[model samples]
Target: MKQSFVYILKCSDGSYYTGVTSNLSARMFKHNSGFYPDCFTFNRRPLELVFYCEFTDINLAIEKEKQIKKWSRAKKEALINDDFDELVNLAKKSFGK
Candidate 1:
Protein backbone atom coordinates (compact mmCIF):
# COMPACT_ATOMS: atom_id res chain seq x y z
CA MET A 1 0.00 0.00 0.00
CA LYS A 2 1.16 3.52 -0.75
CA GLN A 3 1.93 5.66 2.28
CA SER A 4 0.95 9.25 2.89
CA PHE A 5 2.46 11.84 5.21
CA VAL A 6 1.21 14.85 7.10
CA TYR A 7 4.09 17.28 7.61
CA ILE A 8 4.81 20.63 9.14
CA LEU A 9 7.41 22.92 7.66
CA LYS A 10 8.96 25.80 9.56
CA CYS A 11 9.39 28.69 7.22
CA SER A 12 12.41 30.95 7.29
CA ASP A 13 10.19 33.69 8.70
CA GLY A 14 9.29 31.52 11.67
CA SER A 15 5.87 30.52 10.40
CA TYR A 16 4.53 27.00 9.99
CA TYR A 17 3.05 25.37 6.90
CA THR A 18 1.05 22.15 7.09
CA GLY A 19 0.64 19.80 4.17
CA VAL A 20 -0.09 16.24 3.15
CA THR A 21 2.02 14.39 0.60
CA SER A 22 2.72 10.95 -0.75
CA ASN A 23 6.30 11.87 -1.66
CA LEU A 24 7.91 13.80 1.19
CA SER A 25 11.41 14.06 -0.25
CA ALA A 26 10.18 15.33 -3.58
CA ARG A 27 7.79 17.75 -1.88
CA MET A 28 10.56 19.13 0.31
CA PHE A 29 12.78 19.57 -2.72
CA LYS A 30 10.03 21.43 -4.51
CA HIS A 31 9.38 23.68 -1.53
CA ASN A 32 13.05 24.51 -1.05
CA SER A 33 13.55 24.97 -4.78
CA GLY A 34 10.61 27.38 -5.03
CA PHE A 35 9.10 25.34 -7.83
CA TYR A 36 5.83 27.22 -7.58
CA PRO A 37 6.09 30.96 -7.19
CA ASP A 38 2.51 31.27 -6.03
CA CYS A 39 2.84 28.65 -3.33
CA PHE A 40 2.84 29.65 0.37
CA THR A 41 6.30 28.17 0.87
CA PHE A 42 7.72 29.78 -2.26
CA ASN A 43 8.49 33.11 -0.64
CA ARG A 44 8.97 31.40 2.69
CA ARG A 45 11.87 29.40 1.35
CA PRO A 46 14.53 27.51 3.22
CA LEU A 47 11.89 25.63 5.17
CA GLU A 48 12.74 23.11 7.84
CA LEU A 49 10.77 19.92 8.30
CA VAL A 50 9.56 20.19 11.88
CA PHE A 51 7.04 17.35 12.23
CA TYR A 52 5.63 14.46 10.28
CA CYS A 53 3.34 11.47 10.73
CA GLU A 54 2.84 8.62 8.33
CA PHE A 55 -0.57 7.26 7.32
CA THR A 56 -1.53 4.30 5.19
CA ASP A 57 -4.69 6.06 4.11
CA ILE A 58 -4.53 9.26 2.05
CA ASN A 59 -7.91 10.44 3.39
CA LEU A 60 -6.67 10.25 6.94
CA ALA A 61 -3.50 12.09 5.99
CA ILE A 62 -5.50 14.90 4.40
CA GLU A 63 -7.79 15.06 7.42
CA LYS A 64 -4.83 15.30 9.75
CA GLU A 65 -3.30 18.05 7.64
CA LYS A 66 -6.52 20.04 7.82
CA GLN A 67 -6.73 19.56 11.57
CA ILE A 68 -3.17 20.69 12.15
CA LYS A 69 -3.67 23.71 9.93
CA LYS A 70 -6.36 24.92 12.33
CA TRP A 71 -4.17 24.60 15.39
CA SER A 72 -2.70 27.53 17.31
CA ARG A 73 1.04 28.10 17.08
CA ALA A 74 1.53 27.12 20.72
CA LYS A 75 -0.36 23.87 20.20
CA LYS A 76 1.63 23.15 17.09
CA GLU A 77 4.89 23.83 18.90
CA ALA A 78 3.86 21.54 21.73
CA LEU A 79 3.23 18.80 19.20
CA ILE A 80 6.55 19.44 17.49
CA ASN A 81 8.37 19.29 20.79
CA ASP A 82 6.62 16.05 21.71
CA ASP A 83 5.15 17.69 24.75
CA PHE A 84 1.96 15.76 25.09
CA ASP A 85 1.22 17.26 28.47
CA GLU A 86 1.39 20.76 27.13
CA LEU A 87 -0.57 19.73 24.08
CA VAL A 88 -3.39 18.42 26.22
CA ASN A 89 -3.35 21.53 28.33
CA LEU A 90 -3.56 23.75 25.30
CA ALA A 91 -6.44 21.75 23.91
CA LYS A 92 -8.28 21.95 27.18
CA LYS A 93 -7.66 25.66 27.40
CA SER A 94 -9.02 26.14 23.92
CA PHE A 95 -12.02 24.02 24.66
CA GLY A 96 -12.83 26.06 27.72
CA LYS A 97 -12.73 29.28 25.79
Candidate 2:
Protein backbone atom coordinates (compact mmCIF):
# COMPACT_ATOMS: atom_id res chain seq x y z
CA MET A 1 0.00 0.00 0.00
CA LYS A 2 1.14 3.49 -0.76
CA GLN A 3 1.41 6.16 1.93
CA SER A 4 0.51 9.82 1.63
CA PHE A 5 1.65 12.66 3.87
CA VAL A 6 0.49 16.05 5.04
CA TYR A 7 3.48 18.28 5.62
CA ILE A 8 4.30 21.75 6.88
CA LEU A 9 7.37 23.70 5.85
CA LYS A 10 8.86 26.67 7.62
CA CYS A 11 9.73 29.16 4.93
CA SER A 12 12.62 31.58 4.89
CA ASP A 13 10.23 34.42 5.70
CA GLY A 14 9.14 32.76 8.96
CA SER A 15 5.81 31.69 7.47
CA TYR A 16 4.39 28.20 7.25
CA TYR A 17 3.35 26.37 4.10
CA THR A 18 1.12 23.31 4.12
CA GLY A 19 0.95 20.63 1.47
CA VAL A 20 0.26 16.97 0.74
CA THR A 21 2.25 14.49 -1.30
CA SER A 22 2.93 10.81 -1.73
CA ASN A 23 6.66 11.21 -2.22
CA LEU A 24 8.12 13.29 0.53
CA SER A 25 11.70 13.31 -0.76
CA ALA A 26 10.79 14.30 -4.30
CA ARG A 27 8.41 16.92 -3.08
CA MET A 28 11.09 18.44 -0.87
CA PHE A 29 13.51 18.46 -3.74
CA LYS A 30 10.98 20.15 -5.99
CA HIS A 31 10.26 22.84 -3.44
CA ASN A 32 13.93 23.49 -2.86
CA SER A 33 14.73 23.57 -6.58
CA GLY A 34 11.91 25.98 -7.39
CA PHE A 35 10.24 23.40 -9.61
CA TYR A 36 6.92 25.18 -9.17
CA PRO A 37 7.63 28.85 -9.63
CA ASP A 38 4.17 29.85 -8.56
CA CYS A 39 4.18 27.77 -5.39
CA PHE A 40 4.31 29.47 -2.01
CA THR A 41 7.61 27.86 -1.08
CA PHE A 42 9.25 28.55 -4.42
CA ASN A 43 10.39 32.07 -3.82
CA ARG A 44 10.46 31.33 -0.12
CA ARG A 45 13.29 28.87 -0.67
CA PRO A 46 15.42 27.47 2.17
CA LEU A 47 12.32 25.88 3.58
CA GLU A 48 12.64 23.54 6.50
CA LEU A 49 10.45 20.49 6.93
CA VAL A 50 8.91 21.25 10.28
CA PHE A 51 6.06 18.79 10.59
CA TYR A 52 4.51 15.82 8.80
CA CYS A 53 1.90 13.13 9.29
CA GLU A 54 1.36 10.05 7.19
CA PHE A 55 -1.92 8.47 6.13
CA THR A 56 -2.86 5.36 4.24
CA ASP A 57 -5.42 7.21 2.17
CA ILE A 58 -4.49 10.06 -0.10
CA ASN A 59 -7.88 11.66 0.55
CA LEU A 60 -7.12 11.77 4.26
CA ALA A 61 -3.74 13.37 3.62
CA ILE A 62 -5.30 15.99 1.37
CA GLU A 63 -8.06 16.62 3.89
CA LYS A 64 -5.50 17.13 6.65
CA GLU A 65 -3.53 19.48 4.46
CA LYS A 66 -6.64 21.58 3.84
CA GLN A 67 -7.49 21.61 7.54
CA ILE A 68 -4.01 22.71 8.57
CA LYS A 69 -4.02 25.42 5.95
CA LYS A 70 -6.91 27.05 7.79
CA TRP A 71 -5.45 26.69 11.27
CA SER A 72 -4.19 29.63 13.31
CA ARG A 73 -0.41 29.84 13.63
CA ALA A 74 -0.62 29.20 17.36
CA LYS A 75 -2.62 26.03 16.82
CA LYS A 76 -0.20 24.87 14.18
CA GLU A 77 2.71 25.56 16.49
CA ALA A 78 1.09 23.57 19.26
CA LEU A 79 0.69 20.66 16.91
CA ILE A 80 4.26 20.89 15.72
CA ASN A 81 5.47 20.93 19.27
CA ASP A 82 3.30 17.93 20.18
CA ASP A 83 1.55 19.98 22.81
CA PHE A 84 -1.92 18.45 22.59
CA ASP A 85 -3.16 20.31 25.63
CA GLU A 86 -2.08 23.62 24.18
CA LEU A 87 -3.64 22.70 20.87
CA VAL A 88 -6.98 22.03 22.52
CA ASN A 89 -6.73 25.20 24.51
CA LEU A 90 -6.03 27.20 21.40
CA ALA A 91 -9.09 25.75 19.73
CA LYS A 92 -11.44 27.32 22.24
CA LYS A 93 -13.46 30.36 21.15
CA SER A 94 -11.74 33.51 22.26
CA PHE A 95 -14.93 35.64 22.56
CA GLY A 96 -18.13 34.79 24.38
CA LYS A 97 -21.17 33.59 22.40
Candidate 3:
Protein backbone atom coordinates (compact mmCIF):
# COMPACT_ATOMS: atom_id res chain seq x y z
CA MET A 1 0.00 0.00 0.00
CA LYS A 2 1.24 3.47 -0.85
CA GLN A 3 1.69 5.81 2.05
CA SER A 4 0.59 9.38 2.27
CA PHE A 5 1.73 12.21 4.52
CA VAL A 6 0.23 15.30 6.04
CA TYR A 7 2.98 17.83 6.73
CA ILE A 8 3.43 21.28 8.14
CA LEU A 9 6.22 23.55 7.01
CA LYS A 10 7.31 26.52 9.05
CA CYS A 11 8.11 29.27 6.59
CA SER A 12 10.94 31.73 6.94
CA ASP A 13 8.41 34.45 7.67
CA GLY A 14 7.12 32.50 10.70
CA SER A 15 4.01 31.37 8.86
CA TYR A 16 2.89 27.77 8.42
CA TYR A 17 1.82 25.80 5.36
CA THR A 18 -0.10 22.58 5.55
CA GLY A 19 -0.11 20.04 2.73
CA VAL A 20 -0.56 16.42 1.87
CA THR A 21 1.67 14.34 -0.34
CA SER A 22 2.43 10.81 -1.37
CA ASN A 23 6.08 11.60 -1.99
CA LEU A 24 7.25 13.75 0.87
CA SER A 25 10.92 13.98 -0.08
CA ALA A 26 10.13 14.99 -3.62
CA ARG A 27 7.55 17.49 -2.39
CA MET A 28 10.06 19.02 0.01
CA PHE A 29 12.59 19.36 -2.75
CA LYS A 30 10.05 21.05 -4.96
CA HIS A 31 9.02 23.47 -2.23
CA ASN A 32 12.60 24.43 -1.43
CA SER A 33 13.59 24.64 -5.09
CA GLY A 34 10.94 27.18 -6.05
CA PHE A 35 9.43 24.69 -8.40
CA TYR A 36 6.01 26.35 -8.15
CA PRO A 37 6.14 30.10 -8.25
CA ASP A 38 2.44 30.42 -7.46
CA CYS A 39 2.58 28.14 -4.47
CA PHE A 40 2.13 29.55 -0.99
CA THR A 41 5.53 28.28 0.10
CA PHE A 42 7.31 29.56 -2.95
CA ASN A 43 8.33 32.95 -1.57
CA ARG A 44 8.21 31.58 1.93
CA ARG A 45 11.31 29.54 1.24
CA PRO A 46 13.87 28.11 3.64
CA LEU A 47 11.02 26.23 5.22
CA GLU A 48 11.45 24.00 8.23
CA LEU A 49 9.35 20.85 8.40
CA VAL A 50 7.67 21.23 11.77
CA PHE A 51 5.26 18.32 11.76
CA TYR A 52 4.24 15.23 9.80
CA CYS A 53 1.92 12.26 10.15
CA GLU A 54 1.77 9.19 7.99
CA PHE A 55 -1.43 7.67 6.62
CA THR A 56 -2.16 4.69 4.51
CA ASP A 57 -5.10 6.42 2.92
CA ILE A 58 -4.65 9.41 0.66
CA ASN A 59 -8.19 10.60 1.30
CA LEU A 60 -7.50 10.75 5.02
CA ALA A 61 -4.25 12.57 4.41
CA ILE A 62 -5.97 15.14 2.27
CA GLU A 63 -8.71 15.56 4.82
CA LYS A 64 -6.16 16.12 7.55
CA GLU A 65 -4.33 18.66 5.42
CA LYS A 66 -7.52 20.60 4.79
CA GLN A 67 -8.37 20.56 8.48
CA ILE A 68 -4.93 21.78 9.49
CA LYS A 69 -5.02 24.51 6.89
CA LYS A 70 -8.13 25.90 8.58
CA TRP A 71 -6.60 25.94 12.03
CA SER A 72 -5.43 29.03 13.90
CA ARG A 73 -1.71 29.54 14.20
CA ALA A 74 -1.85 28.78 17.90
CA LYS A 75 -3.69 25.53 17.28
CA LYS A 76 -1.26 24.52 14.58
CA GLU A 77 1.64 25.33 16.87
CA ALA A 78 0.10 23.29 19.62
CA LEU A 79 -0.12 20.28 17.27
CA ILE A 80 3.41 20.82 16.03
CA ASN A 81 4.67 20.96 19.60
CA ASP A 82 2.93 17.65 20.40
CA ASP A 83 0.77 19.35 22.99
CA PHE A 84 -2.56 17.58 22.66
CA ASP A 85 -3.96 19.18 25.80
CA GLU A 86 -3.33 22.61 24.43
CA LEU A 87 -4.78 21.57 21.10
CA VAL A 88 -8.03 20.49 22.71
CA ASN A 89 -8.16 23.63 24.81
CA LEU A 90 -7.63 25.85 21.80
CA ALA A 91 -10.29 23.99 19.87
CA LYS A 92 -12.76 24.51 22.66
CA LYS A 93 -11.94 28.19 22.86
CA SER A 94 -12.31 28.58 19.14
CA PHE A 95 -15.66 26.82 19.15
CA GLY A 96 -16.76 28.56 22.35
CA LYS A 97 -18.34 25.35 23.55
Please give, for residues 1-97, the per-residue lDDT of candidate 1 as tens digits: 8999999999999999999999999999999999989999999889999999999999989999999999999999999999999999988744353
| Candidate 2 per-residue C-alpha lDDT over 1-97 given as tens digits, one digit per residue, 9 for 90 to 100 | 7999899999999999999999999999999999999998887989999999999999888888998999999999999999999999988888777
Q: List all candidate RMSDs to the true structure.
A: 1.8, 1.0, 1.9
Among these predictions, the greatest TM-score belongs to 2
The lDDT per prediction is 0.95, 0.93, 0.94
Instruction: Report the error of model 3 at residue 38, Å.
Output: 0.8
What would the TM-score be for candidate 2 when compared with the true structure? 0.95
lDDT of 3 at 48: 92
Per-residue lDDT, model 1, residue 71, is: 98
Q: What would the C-alpha RMSD of candidate 1 be, to one decimal place?
A: 1.8
Q: State the lDDT at 40 in candidate 2.
A: 87
Candidate 2 residue pairs in clash (backbone atoms < 3 Å): none
Between candidates 2 and 3, the lDDT winner: 3
> How do all models score by TM-score?
0.94, 0.95, 0.94
